[model samples]
Target: MTEMTLDPRQLGTGGLFTAAVPDLASHEAAYGRRPSGWTRSPLLRELEASGLAGRGGAGFPAWRKLAAVGAGRPAVIANGAEGEPLSRKDTALLRQAPHLVLDGLVTAGEAVGASELFLYATAESLPGVGQALAERRDGPRVTLVEAPAAFISGEASAVVNALETGTALPRDKAARIARSGYQGRPTLLHNVETLAHLALVARYGAQWFRSAGTADDPGTRLYSLSGDVPAEWVVEAPGGASLRDVLRLGGAEPSSLAAVLVGGFHGAWVPAEAFDLPLTARGLARYGASPGAGVLLALARGRCGLQASAGIVRYLAESSARQCGPCMFGLPAMATVLERIAAGERAPWLASEAERLAGLVTGRGACHHPDGSARFVRSSLGVFKDEVRAHLAGACTAHHGRV
Candidate 1:
């Protein structure tokens, strides 16, 4: 794989999880620094100053989680569940930067006085994480858990629930996982990317971590670039890099994009005209999207946006845990309407019906599944206005809405 970095601000560092720096020793050499060791107070201070946010779609502050698991010998979980269908960055990080992730885990464990460190990773990704763990000589009492490869199973709460009871369903009411998680112990759970950034911050301090990105949200991110690309590639970029520049790393020029899915299934859509949008939290906030799971799926010029969203809606609906009424039922209904719209619905009312269904589904579920699906459905209807018009007129305008 040709590793291309779009950040352009090296900040006296090298590629994060690139193939050339394949393993632990190489990562150490590439980064050229490591934290001596971490203690709680100073570690929390530095992390707070770094202003790192969770990279697992939710942009929650890293310091908030680290600080919230207050004054206990809690547990730490490195989440590599890769539940989002459009995301592959976690697997790549497991394969290439596993040690850095583990180092961050160790640092976090030390800072929080964690007794056990658990890693939740997919079956395909477990081997990589296992290999990295085997090569490590020192760390906390670490355990390896094989995570189910389901979308919702990767939820932070679900991971803890799976570890505790062997049932991987998110809790109905979401509590602060940091304060109370995994056997009712104060736990520090974070995505693998966030942990990797923690390792950087632990070694380099907050300012060094802030050297590359914007002031409000500083540091780098790994984005899984899929769809309409020569090949799937993970691009490393600063917080606020332009969407156009990031997409180019996957061979997607702005002119080639019909519409881009800015976040994961729960994310919003941005028309090609909005290609100038940045990839940060604030940047995406302007467009009403977050860096959810760091997935940037670019739809090519000839693809039908309706068809793409319809399939995803159906998949998300099927993946639901079936615990929530609005999600389990409402989502399937919305998916049906999206499928109808995708199949060149001649009824002009179908669009309004979709809008109605999406509105009904939003905010009604116990989880964000319904909300995100509604966003995907609603955003597709807006971004693919031309396709919607064509479908109403009984035509697909482009490729008969295939894929």
Candidate 2:
């Protein structure tokens, strides 16, 4: 097993985790009393005006998610299930600021007139969350569910499935989780980081929330940085931050890295030349990368990028829920081909075969598992093309094999 080195750091002043909000009183002191009496329409307007997007991989508008639930009793979930292997921001947030997350869950519940609220997180975070719940006297009752240590468990459908059934595998993708989910009720699920941000938005108002980040991408974001850095850190930075600045915050010099995985295991790769690019969807679109899950993994210059990508692809293939043909067969086949190419297989057909397999699995999974896995593998091939050529010539261009 790979060792998880999770250290939390904040970029500027007054952002997430900068305050010591370990318990309820401290949280209240830092953020003031939770703004109450916010109904659906009003809350939607506030979120929309705030321009807050989900900190989760998708970056969907938070207001739209609440509006989608429509009327009737809804279920709200604070998803702290940080199942991405290289991501630890959610776990750090849950441990350090559980009350804020709980407040956000309650805020969302109030907005949707939700009948049930759940805070689902990994075991490492449950104790703090449970304590936060115990500390709270006002607000709707929140049930605590332990999240399993599986990659796909953090997917929205899988989260609902985990609550309905013991297994944390994703169900049908066609079904709209917002309309019918978790015991066939309307469910609004937001990542823990997003909810924490929402909690801040609720208190600070839209303009105040928009004050930090760029006009296009508003508010702050929590990023989990690792891979060839001096240390693993969960850092908070303004939205649309430059990758170079983020690396510097994580104790890594951008010049020393060959490339950086902008997202997590299921994310895309960006060459170091583009390190100056903003960590936003539009900014990274050309590179086939985004701030997905707010994960930035630095690949040091002398490390074998292909070898590192191959290992991650293999892990993703093995982590699949295996509920659909793409996950059950296509991912493993893709992984095998990628591994062969990374292992100095001289065959020219290897790269094309990998591409073919990726196409076969794209958009065919029950969840985004197969698609994300394919994305990672395809990005590896594109970003490490030079390495691929060297390997095809039965040689390696990396100064060292470490990644």
Each candidate: what lDDT? 0.80, 0.84
List where candidate 1 sits over 4 angstroms from the true fold.
1-14, 17-23, 32-36, 397-403
TM-score (all chains, Cα) for each model: 0.92, 0.95
lDDT of 2 by residue, 1-116 (tens): 11222222221123445434377776676678889878989889999998999877888999999989956678999898889978888887887778878888999998898999
Write down the RMSD of all candidates, one decimal each: 2.6, 3.0
Point to the candidate with the largest TM-score: 2
Error of 2 at 317 (Å): 0.8
**Candidate 2 structure, TM-score to reference:** 0.95
Counting clashing residue pairs in each candidate, in order, gives: 2, 0
